[model samples]
Target: MPPDLDPRLTPARPDLADICLRGQVAAERFVEGRPARIAVPSAPLRRRPDVAAGLDTEAVMGDAVTVYDVRDGFAFAQIVRDAYVGYLPEAALGPADPAPTHRVAALRTFVYPAPDLKRPPIAHLSLGAAFAAQAREGEYWQLASGGSVFAGHAVPLGHTEPDAAALAERLVGTPYLWGGRTTLGLDCSGLVQLCLESAGLVCPRDADQQERALGTALPPGLDGLCRGDLVFWKGHVGMMLDAERLIHANGHHMAVAVEPLAVAVARIAEKSFGAVTSIRRLAMTAELAETGAFTPSAAS
Candidate 1:
């Protein structure tokens, strides 16, 4: 059998082997290709079917997923965004729809029952949750989800924030939760992924994966650090706010925090993560260039 087809699609996650490889190794036939979409603001993708199981990632509202099996109240599925397979509550899914028209750009926003902000909210959406806009009412956009959101909070599809590091700063003090992607809680990689995704860059879910996939390596010293530069240590990552400071969601403070890069490096090395592995500078997207967020010196 091909190495990639040995029923372990994600070698890091052994728990999924049974579900992903059932047809090949057991008599149980695997179901294929049932389209679905996330119906909630954010849905937890767990390592197991139980609610208490360790979270693997999150599927935000309107994310496309392919269901391969349904058991109890959970669905075994693969997220279309990153091809990450996991289990999420079956109740959080609904029929797939066309691509969303806008995405929530604020840290959090409410979906009011009507166009009036005074009315009660029907749903609360987090940053990066995509929604289809059906119409405009006053200062609100009517969502296909049957609610209206403030127009200022939703940006047209393909609109991206130019300053990813500045966007991440807004999330300061957010509680750190493993596998969390919302403002309610976020892990290190989740923080990076959310900020970058809002800037229209695709990012992977885990620290190791992000380390492997993002940016070009810089010299092995703090001298090269700059705003938006990525610093990686074994199993952890942080984004530099400037040459002196970095912002990260970490278990040390148990929240997103900023500290002097040198201080953080010493503390993290002494206590947990052993040493810095690499320093990387990301390329500027066209959107960033227009906003002058990236300079020639910053890229180096």
Candidate 2:
């Protein structure tokens, strides 16, 4: 089997088989229910149908999810973006909207009660959260939810950032949180996903899934590492800032930090993470690099 195809890359959620990834139950059971859309700025995707369960990931506002079952005020569903199966509170979902106009481009922004900035904020939105625009005020975009966000902090649906690596640099000091994907806190895969998604590249929600879904594998070794290269170890990943340094949201530091590649390798191994498992690079042309238009090749 190809190295990237290792079964460990895909999470095994056997306990959720009837309602999750495997979908062992009959389709008719879920197909009859209407598809739901995320209504809040962000909702926790949990391992079980309870608030106390571990968070598996987060679904942003306007993201679609197919509801399969509901129990104890929770909805068991699969996120449309990455097909991740989890349970979310029923309150987090509402009638679906097939079209969304813009996505949050800033690390974090407030949703104002009115178009005026002086008005108190009604809610907060994180980067990559989709917003449906109803109208444009002088300096804000009025949302269908009756909240207004700064116009400059959002971009049209299809807009892509020029450099993902450069974008990741902005989160250098963010606190690390397991299963988080926001500026307030984030994990290794969350860092990569946020950075690459901002560049209009599709990315999965976990380090292993990301390893299997993005970029071409490079020959093993540290000799040819470059900016934007993805370096992977068991259950963890980091991006190369250049040939010799890497940045990652790590437990060791409990924050996103940059460290010498050699030092990081030794430290991780000392903690029994094992050696580097793979190195992958996104292919880009000199012109694309200059223009900041990165097109990541799907994993092979």
Candidate 3:
């Protein structure tokens, strides 16, 4: 594989590659990938097939993935939502039919064996997880795969949250996880990605990709910072809560935390990540606000 091709996004290897890449790269063979959907509530996508390998990200229920190759118990696949390629446990996948019609909107929710909430839950789903709803029974939605989830916890696929910053702030105190994007645990980029998705914006998976592709870059300075502004370091990213505060999932706190931008900048600079590389502001939707700005008081 050429060094220029990012392995994180490319479904190619020296031995095999996706048929879609036939003309773009050299490989021993190319094959049309098989389509699959994530069956479990959440499955880790790792850099390597081994469980010990670093997790690159996660695929949630009903997410479409293309399986380019399978070995042992792992499938080398690419998630359609973000085009992220990694090794996922083969057991985590299922048939791609009965496509999703709703997505989990709550931070976390339970899948019950029956419509009754009193029943023991079978599985837990996190925000952004997709599911196919076959019918409504009382206050629960019957899933195509056989289960019921609280109807209020999910919304139609087209639904979107009004404020990205406020939505992210709801996850304050989420545990810092290297490659997780669930309420169970999450990383800096994962937090930003989830929040952006809630606001109906497409975002790339990693911080470096997010910095390079998301929003319009603002000239160097903290004076113009506002809610929804993305503050990026070399390998990390965070959202500004306002002109003075920033919220991020950080190893230093091992959780999502909010602090003055000046304090975070000085601490991060003195400790490890060096300094802020850029501050980019997202184009606000009309729903975000008429003035395209957010205040903590209003959210409260």
Candidate 4:
């Protein structure tokens, strides 16, 4: 190892394992893809950090609620479900979901359902884990565990609505895994879809589908974007804010983070080598909006 480099960091990188939306573009052209940032429940590509690897370590087991925070050199997330909250990295799991609901009487848990592809019989979810909810009530929730929704616990602490603002803020630092969606990890459109769905909205899970759901087109510029507006390019998507910024769970930078809209636009432009695409409003059709369904794109 070179003395100039950090000692705790290793040289191995990560890779992708899956994609929720079929025929999605690669991470190399995030902005050009569509929603500038989405969710990826699959393990992402990246190198290992030796020193930060063991620093302030906390175990995120099954049925845990974690909140992604910072993403400087490495990804950082804290468990917010129950008592399991702290910092962890992005390279831990294969294809994690966003707030995946799982119930475990102990450290050992099982495959969530749709997530139970091979029917792992009793696949184990560690303590301090994460899951995406498909069903919910007072104390229990149905999640898209491996691929289906089984019963589980640990949803948002208080209320659960499909508010884009709240959902956008939730996945703040989630690592940008290639196919991950859990607090365990996330990607660009995956972030948008996950948080929106959790809020009670029913938008499409992919960027193009999202473009269809949004209805209105972004034109050629973003002069009138407000918070919760869906921003899309070619193969990527993200949330735009009145603060002249956008937030998305991206794979290029490899995590959820805020970026200047100009910088983001520039990055996408450079990558695609083309003009900016479209930006869509989150507001639903007149009928839909009148019904007060403009909370979140993923709200069901």
State which candidate has the highest TM-score.
3
lDDT of 2: 0.80
Query: 1-300, model 4: which lDDT tens digit per residue?
Result: 234432222211122211321234222211111111112222222223334332222333332323232344334332222122223444443233354333222222455334443554434443224455665543335544433323443434333454565656766777776544456566676677666655546555456567766647755676755567778877688886443778887766788988887888888787752445677765533334457544223322
Candidate 2 structure quality by residue, lDDT tens digits, 144-231 = 8778999999999899987777778889899998998888888999999989888878888898888888888988888856678899
Candidate 1 C-alpha lDDT tens digits along 1-300: 345452213412323333455544433343345789998889999877899899888989989988877889999888887767778899999889866899999999998999998998988999999999999988999988788999999899899998789999999999999988899999999999999988888887788878888888887788845688888999899998877888999999999999988898999999999899988777853334457665423532
Clashing pairs in 3: none
Looking at model 3, residue 292 earns an lDDT score of 44
Highest-lDDT candidate? 3
Clashes of each: 0, 1, 0, 90
* Candidate 2 off by > 4 Å: 1-33, 285-300
Q: Candidate 3: lDDT over CA atoms?
A: 0.90
In angstroms, give how far residue 256 of model 1 lies from its true place: 1.0
TM-score of each: 0.88, 0.86, 0.96, 0.46
> Residues 50-69, candidate 3, lDDT per residue (tens digit)?
99999889989989999999
Q: Candidate 3: minimum summed lDDT over ten consecutive residues — where?
A: 291-300
How many angstroms is residue 287 displaced in model 4 relative to the true structure, after the best TM-score fit? Answer: 11
- The local distance difference test score of each candidate is 0.83, 0.80, 0.90, 0.48
Preferred candidate (TM-score higher): 3 or 4:
3
